[model samples]
Target chain A: MQRSLAARVAARTAALRLTNEKLYNEILERRKAERALRATERKYRGFFENSIEGAYQSTAEGQYLNVNPALARLYGYATTAEMMAAVGNIARDVYADPEMRLRFQEMIERDGKVRNLEYQVRQRTGEILWISESARVVRNRSGKIVCYEGTIRDITARKRAEDEAARLRQQMLQLQKMDAIGTLASGIAHDFNNILGGIMGYVELAQDDLPPGSGAESHLKEVWKAIHRAKQLVRQILAFSREAAPERRKVRLAMLVSEATRLLRATIPATVAIEEEILTETDEIIADPAQIHQVLVNLGTNASHAMSGRAGRLLLRLEHAAIGGKKPALKLSVRDTGHGIPPDILQRIFEPFFTTKGVHEGTGLGLSVVHGIVKSHGGEIRVESTPGAGTTFMIFLPLALEAPQ
Target chain B: MAHILVIEDDEHMRGSLAQTLERLGHRVTTAVDGKVGVASAAVAPPDLVITDLIMPEKEGLETIMELRQHQPSIRIIAMSGGGRLSNEDYLHLAKRFGAQFTLAKPFTRDELKAVLAQALAS
Candidate 1:
């Protein structure tokens, strides 16, 4: 009986030792698994920290759960801690357009991932940055979205390049307009020069044949004066065409108007009464004296023609005015008590070859040429009139001052 | 009285020029083109020749050059509408090739007469 009890004790001891050894081996295996998991997490953190592109992880509510250094720099912050502290709501501060964030959420929910989404983002410094993002939705085991993971790339340089290209297109259009004008001028000068030559030649030949102080000489003299007037018209055409240089000078507006009025009175019918009103002593203006005279004469002639076959008052007024607070200007107003311009026709008046006057009486280019001259001189002209009441034309020219050396 | 040849492509302008020259007490002949003018001049050389620069079949420059080669002393007056060859270089070229004077187109009748008279006297 003693030998059997000893054998049972020995077997029980062996069984207890075997159970302890099995437990120790199990603990070692678990520790090795934990170490491997920790190494994997450390590798992921290093990759996120050293990435050039912005890396971020956010909750479905747009709360930033984690952000890398690149993401903080992109948000105009010196450090990730400062960026996190300042921007609590990524939807409000980062997304320039709030709709973009909503769209991103919708895309992630529908596809479980969003790729290459472009948006304008506002940084901490209030500067706009163009960004493209590729993100994936982090979902729970139940398939509900919990967080978002994304990589961002700066695309501001690409956006600026597109804007610059658009500006260059506009500049090319302006250059084309100037080129067309140059071509037109060269064509017209050829034909006009021929007509003047014939007129001048005939006048000279007629003068030589008629002899001085003859009865025919007086009639010939009248024809010669007409030719001289035509010559002046040619000069104006050449100036308008930019083939001839305009003679520019400092002119007194009041004196110019008075002179024009006196000249008009001599040729105007007795039925047509002329009046003048000088309101400002500010008569100084820089312009071509002869060209301005032509403008005044054209306006006066137009007024006279409008009042033909009827008695009317032709009023010329001069005044001083300031424009844009930059410089003073001389304003000349020519008002006629004749038929006014129709509203529909008012816009068309400044267009070339658009005239209400009968053929041979008017070349629709008058107002168009006037507009061109005014634009070239950096001045402005306004026309105000009511149909049947009469028309008034006001011309504004910059006041002449001594140019800096 | 000097015999003058007027070469022009326009019939009306040629007729008018002929009338003016005849009125000036000179015998005048008209040709509507440079080739006809050249042939006419070659057949019967005139004391003076006035030619328009641009013409069909033959241009004025060629006519003047051919005429000059035939009769170097023949007084030549060139007229241009101030088109392609109106620049000083063209004028200089005309002078170099034996043209006595170059009158810009659309020149007054007086200017033409004066230039003609000067060319003839020289």
Candidate 2:
């Protein structure tokens, strides 16, 4: 009996010792696995901190799990801790437009990864910056989305440079348009000047041959009058051809208006009434006399045509005013009681070849030429009108103190 | 009356020139091309010839050269609108090829009469 009992005790002690050894081995294996996980995390942290681009990890719900110092600086925060405290949800706090975060989520869900997503992100100070991000979904072992990891780079300066280059290209196109118009004018002027020379020469010869009191002399006088009218037409052509220079002279605005009105009265139908209001007696301006005359004539003719088949009043008013506190200027306003310009067409009225008149009646260069002349003389012209009311053109020219002899 | 021959390609300008010269009491003959002009000048030897520079079949420079060879002292007047040639080049070629004088296109009646009178006197 004693020997049997002793064998039992020995068996039990051996079983206990085996169990302890197995437990110790299991603990050691678990400790080794923990150390390996810590090393991997340390290596990842080091890489994230040292990288130039911003590194971040966010939950699918947009909660930040980890962010590098580079990310905090990129977002205009002083430290990662500060950014984490303020920016609780990246989708809500950092993205200026919340739709951007949703778009990123959609991209990743569709493609398993989102590449180079560019958007404007709001900083801590409410300022916005452009950021480019490339990110991938972080998944658990079962392929379920847990978080997202991404790199961000600032691209604001590059975007600004592209916009500036586009603006300069548009400006160059406008200059090219002006250059082409100048070339066309030079060619047309050379041909037209020759024709005018022939006409003028023959008129002078016809005048010398006709007797003073005969019927032929009266007929010759009428022909001479027509030739004089044709010469004025030639001058207008020369203006566009670049052959004629602007004849600048210091003249009173009142006298210019009177002379223009007197000439226009003969051409406009007797039904249309013409009136003038000279507010300033000494309002003087330096301008090309011939060009100014042409401007007045063109405006008057346009007004007459606008009031065709209707009784209307055309008013030519001259006044003196100060602009921008610099100098006093003479203001000439041509107002007509006729159909007003539409809103859509007012913007393009000064463009070349844009006219409402029927074919063969208007060349469409009248307003464009007027605009060019006004711009060349350092003056300003503006049109004011309503849909139902008539239109008024007010031209402001710097006043000249010296008077013509 | 002085007999004058005119050669021009454009119908309107040619007709205007012929009428103006006829009104001035000069006998005028019109030709539409340089070859016809040269042939007319050769057969009749008109008192004066005014021909345009650019034309079909026979150009103005060649016509002037051939006309001078046929009638050495025929008194030719060259006219052009300076279309393809510069003013200086046109004058140079005309004088070089034995033309008495040259006038630009769209010439006035007075200028035509004066140049014709000068060419006839010379």
Candidate 3:
């Protein structure tokens, strides 16, 4: 009986050892599988962290569930946590146009995916950024949408470059139009000059045949003067069309002021008269004769408009001034007895596009262009006025040391 | 005084111009266009041919060139009341085509006379 009992106990011990070894191998296999799974998860996490393209996962209700660092940076946030806190609803708060996100969602829902969808989004800083997104709807086994997954790429720089190219093309077209107008203007000016030539030549021929101081000769002189004024108008139009650079030369201001006033007299109502106080003898400045003539004409026109057809005196003065009795400068002043400028707007008179005149009356560029021309020639201009009395514009220009070449 | 040929398209202008030249004591012949003017000049070969630059047939530029080919020593005066080109531009071209003198239209009689004197003297 003792020997049988000992043999059964030995068999039981061997079976227990065999079961323990199998349990140990099974535990080792499970640990190896767990370690392999953890390595795969880490590889994907690294991809999410280092990717340049923005990646995000959002709930069906538009709440951000997961966002990579790139996505946070693109939204103008310091961190993903900050982006999530700042943006509560993606469709309402993120999209520049909320409808765009709705359309994107509808497309993803219908097709299971959307590729290269373009939209504008407002960054956290309140600036709009152009972006293109490729996204897919994440659904559960029941085919119900649980969330959305997508990548966003900023296309703001590309859009800006395209806009700049379009602007350049428009500018080129404007320049071409100007060139065509210039060609047409040349032809018109030639024809007008020919007509004037006929009138001037006949008047001179009739004068040559007339006796000295005859009444007819004096009458012919008046007709010739009118034609001279007409010629000046034509020249001004030609200069504008050609955009010719002012022909800079030593020019006397007195001659230009009187000529401009004489031309103004024929156009303005007789109630308005012109006065001149030009005393500068041979005081010459380097200038384009036509441009100086234009400056006077513009100021005279402005003065006339201010008067508004009422009787008034337009005083034009040209003089030589010495600052502190040392440095010499040429001074010109245009004074108008009219409804003067109000104090509030006097400062903005020289600002470009600031005009009180109606659209058909003026472009408001007159004063600004005058200011630019004076500044380019090293000059200063100022205005003085009393609301009820009158207004005067004073212009000072440095004398050319030697005539500009 | 020399024999002058006036080629003008406008009748009124031609009449006035012809009268003025006659008063200055010069013998003058008139033609309506460059074609008639060339034929008239070839028949008589006047001392000086005053041709208009822009004409309906055989325009002034071509007229001047053709006249120079026929008579290399011909004294020619070209005048124009500008067309598509500027009067100065037309005048410059005329000078290039062997015109001795160029007058812009509606020029003073004294101016025309002065150009004629200079052309005849040279």
Candidate 4:
């Protein structure tokens, strides 16, 4: 019996040892799993903090819940917490247009996600910037949307570049249309000149047959003078369309203006006065002499026409101006005190064959020729006018690099 | 007064021009266009041929060339209202093509007389 009792004790001891060994193994396995899980958490945290693309999570109500440093820097903030504090109301404080945030939420709600949404947002400095965002709705365990996760890319520079390209394309199209009109104008002026030549010739022949003091001779002379004026009109159109390669040379603008205005002074009526103010330190430019002469005459003729049969004053002024600290330019101004051109008509003053004068008085090529000549010289022309207050036309031409002494 | 042939395309221009020349005391003959002018001048070869440069069937420039080829000694005066190239220097080419003188259309009776006088004196 004593022997049986000792065997039973040994069996019970063996059983207790087995249970302790099994419990120790289970604790060791649980410790290994905890270490592996810690490593995984560190890897995911590094990815969340260091990504260059702006990463963010926002509540369904558009409140920013979490934002990476890249996102903080994008809004011109030094830290993510500071940006979060300043931008409490995302719709009011972040987006330039509040409607954009509402659209973002509606998109994520309807589509379950939103990618590449373009929007304009205001920075902390009050500067507007364009951004492209990609995002998806974050859902709870029950599949209900709890927040939105998003990424942003600033695209302001690319948007500005596209806008400038469109503007240049529009300008190029306008220039091409003007060139077509010039070619057509040259063809018509040629035909008109020939017909006038016939009329003038016959009138001159008829005048020779009349006696020296006859009333018929006086009438023919008046008709002959009128024909000469029409011939001048045709000449203006020819000059505008000729595209005759300009003979470029050193041009003295002051002398040209002086000669033109002196001749103009004679033609101007007694009531209308002509004044000159030559104040330019640099008055020379490289251009075609004949074309510059034509520009001055054409501008002067327009000023005279604006005051015909009405009392007015014509002012011709010149000055040297340095534009934006670049090369010096000469500014020539033709100002007149007369009934100013109406706003609608002023826009079309440079169009070829567009005129308001009586049919026989003008062919409307005068201002068009002036504009063409100025452009050929690499110059710019602008006008300032107010109805009843008169008009002022300003011409800016680059000064010659080396003027002839 | 001289025997002159006027070759013009327009009938009214031809008639009035004929009257002007005849009133200036010259025996004048007329042709409706460049082709008839060349044909008429070839028949008799008038002393002075006043040919218009722009005409139907045969142009004035060609008419002048044909006249020079046929009647080398016939004095020629080329007149043009600038057919297709009014703005071009077409009148200068007329003199180069053997037209003794070139005149832009719509000339006074006195201007015509001077050219004829110069032609006659030469």
Candidate 5:
């Protein structure tokens, strides 16, 4: 009986040892699994922290749950924690337009993912920047959206470049269209001049045969007036089409302006007050005096027309200007306290043959000729108008260097 | 009175010009084109020649050069109603080709008289 009892105790001891060994081996296996899991987590965190693109995790309500360092910097924040604290709602605090966020959410919900969604967002400094994002909706086991995860890149420079290219392309197309029109107009003008010459010659001969102060003489005077009008129209068309190259020389702009203003004074209505404010000490420019004179006359005429039938002030001013470290320039401004041009018509003012005046009042080539002259002179023109107030035309021309005495 | 030759393709313009020259008290001869004008000058050699720039047979520039070579002392006046080029441009080119005077067509009688007198005096 004693031997049997000892054997039972030994068997119980071995069973206890086996149970302890199993327990230790289980602990070692659990530790190995935990280490591997921690290593994988560190690797993913490294990717999140060091990525150049902004990585983010936000709730369905547009609250950022996690943001990488790159995302914090992109939003103009110094720290991820600071950005999280500041940006309470992504749509309100981040998006330039809140509607974009709704669109983004709709896209993700419908497609389960979004690739390269472009958006404009407001940065921390209140500056708007363009950003491109690729994101996916994180769903729970029940297929309900839990959050959104995304990577974003700042694309403001790219967006600006694209916009500038499009603008340049549009400008090129406009130039080509204008050139085609000019060629066609010039062809017609040449033929018209010939026919006009024949009529004018005949009319002059007939006038010489009629006695002065007779009723026929007065009637011939009217015919002469019509012929003069036709002549002026042909000349204007030629100028607008740039058929005749301008003869450029060293021109005294001050003298030209005074001469033009004097003519304007006589031609425009006497009711309109004329004011000249020539402030520049050196008003020399290497330009065609005739073309420059025409520019002034055209601008002045338009100013007078704007003030017609109303007692308004016409102001002509010349001043020196510094323009972005470029060549020295002179700025000539024609301002009138008359009815301003409407916004819709202002943009089309430089187009050839675009006129708002009555058929007899204008030929519609004035501004177009002015624009062409300015462009050929390597200058620029700008117009500003306020409805019911006035209109101002500013012309910038390069100053001519002093010639040798 | 000076003997003059007028070269013009238009019939009415040629008649009007011939009458005007007669009124101005000049002996006038008319030609239909540069070819006829050159031939007439080669035969008669008038004191002054007023030729249209754009013509059917031979243009004014070529006519002026040929006429200048034949009669270097003969005074020449170039006229045009303009064509592909402006009248001023054509007149400018004509002046370069030994034409002593230039006229844009449809010129007033006074303008015509002025250039005619200048050409005769020169």
Candidate 6:
């Protein structure tokens, strides 16, 4: 009996030891699993906090639930908390065009995610930025969208670079076109002038042969007048095409402006009022006086035509301008109270042979000649027009350093 | 009346110039180009010469230089329809090359007469 009792005690002790070892091993395994889980969470959190790109989470109501530090600075905010507080309505406050938000939502709903969606967005400072976003919708068990998460990258620099390149290409094309036209105009001028000379010589001889007050003489006189008009047109073309350096002289710009204004008053309809204001203290510039006179006359003529025969006022003003740190320049502005240039035609106004006038009214070389003369003189010309109101042309010419000659 | 030589390449221009000079009470001789004009001038030595600048055989600048060297006292008038440069620019060059006066083609009768009178008076 004693031996049987001892064996039962030993077996019970072994069974208890075995149960304790199994329990301890289970506890150790659970602890290892908890540690690994904590490490994985920490790794993901580090990625989220330290990412260079902007990361964001927003609820379905366009309320930002969370935003990383990079996103705050991109939207011109001090901190992520400040950004979230200021941007309550993401569509209205953030998207440049609120409709873009709707489009984003629709696309994401259709495709479950969107990649590299580019758009313009408004910052807290009211400045604009181009941003590219990649986003996905977070859904619940029932497949209902609960929130949205995205990464955003600033793309404004790239957008500006692309725009600048396109503008440069356009400018190059325009210059090439002008060069070709100049070549063509000069080529034909020689033959055309010769032919015109021959015709004029014959007509004059015929007129001299006819008796005084004869009908034939009058008809030939009319033909001579027509030829004179043609001659003037050719001269304008030559002026535009000529690459010869101008005869520059140091002259007071005020004198030329006054002379051009006087001519303008005499030529344009008397009904259209002429207002002149010469406000510059120093008006001397080294330029070809004839070309400068032509510039003023052309600008004045263009202004008069803009009125289309309606009663209006043409204002010519010469003022002093201090342009940055460079040399002081004289500003000559020709303003008209008439129908303004439309936006579509404004960019092309300086191109040769571009005109809105009838065939008999204009040769379409006025502004182009003005442009050429200004460029040759190291000056700049700019135009500002409002569709219904009027137009103003501003010319900036560098003032001569020497005293009046 | 002054003796004049008119040199031009265009037939009508040459004819018309001769007629105008004759009407102005001057004896006129005509040539097709600068080469013919120089040969004619060397043969008879006219009192005055009106030459076109752009001609086939010889250009006006060279012809002006040759004639100026041949007879320093002879009066010369340069005319041009203009080529690559403007008529004014070419005419300015002609003046530099010893031509006494210059005319752009398609000039009026009055303009031609004025230059003619000026050249003769000086």
lDDT of 1 at A162: 61
What clash pairs does model 3 have? none
Considering just chain B, what TM-score does every model have?
0.91, 0.92, 0.96, 0.91, 0.97, 0.97
Pick by TM-score: which candidate is best?
5
- Give the DockQ (2 decimals) of all models: 0.14, 0.07, 0.09, 0.12, 0.17, 0.29
lDDT of 6 at A136: 95
State iRMS for model 6.
Answer: 4.6
Worst 10 residues of 5 chain A by lDDT: A168-177
TM-score of chain A of 4: 0.54
**Model 6 segments more than 4 A misplaced:** A1-33, A138-146, A168-192, A208-215, A236-399, A402-405, B1-15, B18-87, B93-100, B116-122
Worst 10 residues of 6 chain A by lDDT: A168-177
Q: What TM-score describes the B chain of model 4?
A: 0.91
Q: What lDDT score is found at residue A40 in candidate 1? A: 84
Please write out the lDDT profile of model 5 over residues A1-405, one tens digit for every residue. 999999999999999999999999999999999998999999999999999999999998999999999999999999999999999999999999999999999999899899999999999999999999999999999998899999999999999967865664564455446556765676666566656656666777777787777788888889889977887887778667664567988887888888777777756788999989999889988899877977888888899888889899999999997545577988999999889999989976874456899976775667866876787687888999987789999999989887685
Estimate the TM-score of every prediction: 0.49, 0.42, 0.48, 0.49, 0.59, 0.58
DockQ value of candidate 5: 0.17
Q: Please state the error at residue A70 of candidate 1 in Å.
A: 2.6
Ranking of models by DockQ: 6, 5, 1, 4, 3, 2
Who is ahead in lDDT, 5 or 6?
A: 6
- RMSD of each candidate? 22.9, 21.7, 20.8, 18.2, 17.0, 16.2
- Candidate 3 residues B1-122, lDDT tens each? 88999987766567767777887889999999999989998999989998877666776766887888888999999987653234555676678777979987656677887999899998
Model 4 stretches with alpha carbons more than 4 Å out: A1-38, A202-405, B1-122
Q: Show where candidate 3 strays beyond 4 Å.
A: A1-52, A59-63, A68-129, A134-145, A194-230, A244-405, B3-106, B110-114
lDDT of 4 at A157: 95
Shares of reference contacts reproduced by the candidates, in order, are 0.30, 0.10, 0.15, 0.15, 0.20, 0.49
Candidate number of the best lDDT: 6
Model 4 per-residue lDDT tens digits across residues A1-405: 888999999999899889888888888888888878888878766777898888899888868999999888988899999999998888898999999888888888999888889899998898898999999997889999888898998999988866755654454355435445654765566456546655765675687679879988888888988887876776666556555456888888898788767656645576778889999767888988767866876777788777878889999998897644476889999999877899989976875456799876776667766776687688888888888868899988889887347
**Colliding pairs, model 6:** none
RMSD in Å for model 2: 21.7
List candidate 2 stretches off by more than 4 Å. Answer: A1-33, A88-92, A97-102, A139-144, A194-405, B1-122
